[model samples]
Target: MSMGSCDINALKLMKKGSVPGMDMAGTVMKCSTGMWKEGDRVCGMLLGGLSSTIVDKKMLDRYGMQGSCATYCRTQCDMICKVPETMPFEEACCMPCCMMMSFQAFNLKTWPYSNKSHEPILVLGAGTSLGLMTCQLGSMMGYKIMAVCEMTEMADVMSFGAEKTFDCNDPQIVEKIMKATQNALTMAMDCSSTDSSLAIAAKCMGSSGGTICCFPLMMMSAGGKTEELMTMDDDSKMETMMEKTMGINMHNIKIVRKLPTTMFGFDAEMMGCMFKPMPDETKHAHAFLKTFSTWMAEGKMKVLPSQMAQNQGMKNLILCMEECKSGGSKMMCKRLVCAMGETGPSV
Candidate 1:
């Protein structure tokens, strides 16, 4: 209703100290005093949330951002996603980042990760932002996606089209993968960087095919993953035992980097790619926007509204992210909605 209302809405997103809306973003533009239009619809993450930081038309043109997450997103589109009209906003929000990684994974010529199709592909940490979309798109494109979760979440993991799923905590997990694929599934993608998950996926990989997984070279230990993986659990006992038990000197001849991305990708929120019925030369951001808009229009997607929480302002941002992180399935829009406040199941 007023500038104060929107500023408060922005506060609901960050919930921290008052960051001038201009200072809240990656780069800034002078408002020229008169440009601060009353009642402008703006949305942003950290940078946009704090100050008047936003990717104005000029900057959006310069960097080619798709108008997703940023410091200040006043003019690109309504900061609040339109719900009911699209697949709930939360599910739509879920796609932007996850789809980017999926696009990267799909772009690779070495799909199925293995030389053969139907080898029982694995999506490690299959419930996270990127992993879930990867599984969804991977399944859409005819690749079977077998997801992995802790023992507690295996069933939920399988529901996402993991024809086969496993509990990473199982001692006989490798045995499980082998038996499931008739020992043919050599491909795996671990979105989570945890050492135990890495080792589990790696050991399960057949000796002669790609085991696709995403982890930082930094998060990995000295001598790299195979070495780091051996030390996953209680370092002393697991490391010593793994080395002796597995004779773990295997070269990573089959391991492949899922994508070459950095933490900046997360910080910058350049973490997503939109899906298209056709893959073309349209710039990444443009293609994504087109897909997102069209999908919402066609009733192919939906949005569930996020009601504002009382009293809490931008400080709720962390709480919001935590909710998204903790709810797992609920967070990823297994037919749901989310906004500045919360997510609820799809109507």
Candidate 2:
């Protein structure tokens, strides 16, 4: 494929004979690897469903189906991955998207969280993938951490970085957070988009305010109840700041969207090849696509607390997608492996 083309545009080019050997998977099947020969294990995010086989969806291999999934470049919002061997393809799949957004919000260099000497900075969903990384990253940078998530996951979450834990479902969660921070807590990264959690983040943020960093994955599921959680029409929960013309604090801690370009950019058709020529970038490529896998192997990053399965492949994918609409916790780090599959993502 010419470096000038990307995603579906490249697919169009392939059909037109301008590009050759372009598999529907969105990668040039016949590109010269230079030193790395064919059949070597390379990890990447496919555009296909992780539940059933991509072949079931169409006729392509599972990985190819994801690469070639209907998510043409225009629809994909610039997320992509090329599989690497040392890294399990499953874990690496969504990291591009998660890391790209989270690192921006939690950039230790720029927006450092408070340490033990100061009030602990809270990550609302520290058990999830972004929360876990925020945990490690915050720990690496010396931030006093508190993770609010499922009761069962608290031990692992605390191991990551949090010093405290609480149930997200508790009605008095804000009061609990207040107690945790000695009523001085202000900064928080609300990784989950459940309206209630957002409300909790705002209420706990002091009147003077603190930063509210939200991942805004409005497309993934938090749990089986994500649809109900996000679709709730509650008025008393998240207040619209009519004064600032924005909901939630209006102007207190700055609210910025964390566009995860780094994660999505790796397999992104636009810039994936741009860094290929840099000799030193070998490590970057390895690090970029494989960070999740590496972390999983090291156990610093853990998977979801349960082994869940989808039975109907794409059909279940559509059925399960409803919860994602409100955006719950699907973005966590645990590799949701297809229980039946032998290679790549489950289905």
lDDT for each residue of candidate 2 in 41-152, tens digit (9 for 90 to 100):
3323332221121113233221233332222211121122344344444344434434434455654432223455645778877777667666666665576777888887
| Cα lDDT for residue 309, candidate 1 | 25
TM-scores for the candidates: 0.53, 0.53
lDDT of 2 at 42: 32
Off by more than 4 A, model 2? 1-40, 44-100, 107-119, 127-130, 183-186, 206-208, 219-251, 261-300, 303-335, 339-342, 345-347
* lDDT values for all models: 0.41, 0.43
For 192-260, candidate 1 gives per-residue lDDT tens digits of 655556566656666564444543321332243444442243323444544466564334424433322
| Weakest ten-residue segment in model 2 by summed lDDT | 1-10
In every candidate, how many clashes are there? 39, 31
Q: Note each model's CA RMSD in angstroms.
A: 10.7, 11.0
